[model samples]
Target chain A: NAGVTQTPKFRVLKTGQSMTLLCAQDMNHEYMYWYRQDPGMGLRLIHYSVGEGTTAKGEVPDGYNVSRLKKQNFLLGLESAAPSQTSVYFCASSSDSGKLLSYEQYFGPGTRLTVT
Target chain B: DQQVKQNSPSLSVQEGRISILNCDYTNSMFDYFLWYKKYPAEGPTFLISISSIKDKNEDGRFTVFLNKSAKHLSLHIVPSQPGDSAVYFCAASWGRSYKYIFGTGTRLKVLA
Candidate 1:
């Protein structure tokens, strides 16, 4: 199983450019999440979906939006890129909502985004 | 506020020795704790986890000990191998929230 895979391994955008980072998982997980990792900082949640068509904001959701149209796929969108959004983005999925079961997250190869 | 914290930024241990990594959390609502390992340019991988009801959980050479009273947890790897070298992150989640709070990773170097 590919487990979890992310598209556009690396991206460079000028301020105001819009783009989407795609995440696909084959694990048949019920939960999906988007997180960004900055240097020397812990990975922070941006948004998540308990199931398809369900979305919720997370700790650091500013400048980012997410869509989970299909259970196997989750997309993170940056409508207007900013220098502050330059960081490594990660996508994860789990078997359950993680509240009642193991919250163990399987992450994908991160997408490095740079805005200048 | 950062709920999870790995006080040590880095730790070095000789090959074949025991390596202990520590983590602490500030939220009492957290009922589940997890540890993840990451290599350069890669995302964090789930390692081991311990529930609040139990103080210790073991899997192979990796063991996680939770001291709920102190709000501290530690990971112990015995006979550590160089391949175990990586950045370790601790995370916590509650029973009602799906969001997991992560700690600034602690980089471990298992010297050969």
Candidate 2:
């Protein structure tokens, strides 16, 4: 089903440059999330959407913005890229059916971003 | 504050041996815990999980154990093989929260 897919597997941006990351899922999940993984820091949530047309801040939402206009797509935007933003970003989707299996998330291959 | 923690940065185990990875969480509100495995250049995949109501959950060669009192959980892989080598992450979530707090991954190296 291609599960979840993320655009631009890799990218390099200069400080103050802006760009957007796109994520798509074919599973019709009701929940979508954006997370960044830094060396020895694990994956920290930047933002998440409980459903289409809704978004919420997470553990580390600074320097990032998100939008979920459609049920199958979620987008993460960087208004002003910075060197500290260099990391591997992952997009994940899951269902919110209150079922045990629903808690398991499907992730994309990840987008490696480097901001200089 | 780091809610979830994987103390060991890396672990190595001989083939056919048991590989146990440990995780600890600071929040008692966490009712569900999960383990994800990631290979180089790939995203993390679900491995196994355990809920607060159950002490253990087993699936094929993988098993997850939860000690509620200690606020600790562990993933065990029996007869570890070279193919099982990867970085493992532990995540925790409370109630019906869709957000998960992840721990710094622990890299596992299974030597054949």
Candidate 3:
């Protein structure tokens, strides 16, 4: 079974362009998250969803929007891409058993997005 | 301000030697700590974790030490091997929630 998968492994977008990154997990986990990684900076949370039809803003959710329309898919959308938005995006999922401190999070390979 | 901090950007150690990666957090409310290892072009993977109530936890060659009073934690890899080389990240959460604050990862190089 594919634990976690992200679509569009690589993409390049010009400033003011828009795109969406899709993340799908087969684990049927209740928690899904989107994070961006930059040089010297660890993964920063962009957005998260605890369950389907529920989304919440994370630490760095300024220029991103997320939708968890289905239980297995979490989508991150860039309404207006900026140069600063160029970074590797990672999607992760975990169970919502209230024991996340012990359970591990499954992550996708990541999508490399370059905004020029 | 970054609530979690990894002072050393990178570390190098000879094979079979001990490798210690340090991490500090400013928030006292953080009760759960975890360590994740990532290879180049891959996502981070869970390595080990420790609860605030515990001072130390060990699993095989990896050990995680937590000091709640000082808001500090560390990961120690004994008899480091070349395969152990990777970017190590320390993350903390306040409770059972999924909101984890990660520190600037420290790249560990194990020389063979």
Among all candidates shown, the one with the greatest lDDT: 2
Candidate 2 on A8-81: residue-level lDDT in tens?
Answer: 89999999999999999999999999999999999999999999999999989999999999999999999999
Which model is ahead, 1 or 2, in terms of TM-score? 2
Q: Write the per-residue lDDT of candidate 1 for residues A13-76, one digit (tens) a residue.
A: 9999999999999999988999999978889999999999999999999999899999999999
Residue A46 lDDT in candidate 3: 97
* lDDT for predicted candidate 1 compared with the true structure: 0.93
Candidate 2 Cα outliers beyond 4 Å, as residue runs: A97-102
Candidate that would win on TM-score:
2
For candidate 3, lDDT tens digit of each residue in A17-48? 99999999999999999999999889999999
Indicate the TM-score of model 3. 0.97
* Candidate 2 lDDT, B23-67, residue by residue in tens: 999999999999999999999999988889899999999999999
Could you give the candidate ranking by TM-score, starting with the highest?
A: 2, 3, 1
Q: Model 3 clash pairs?
A: none
| Residue B103 displacement (Å), model 1 | 0.4
Question: Alpha carbon lDDT of residue A69, candidate 3?
Answer: 96
Residue A38, candidate 1: Cα error in Å is: 0.7
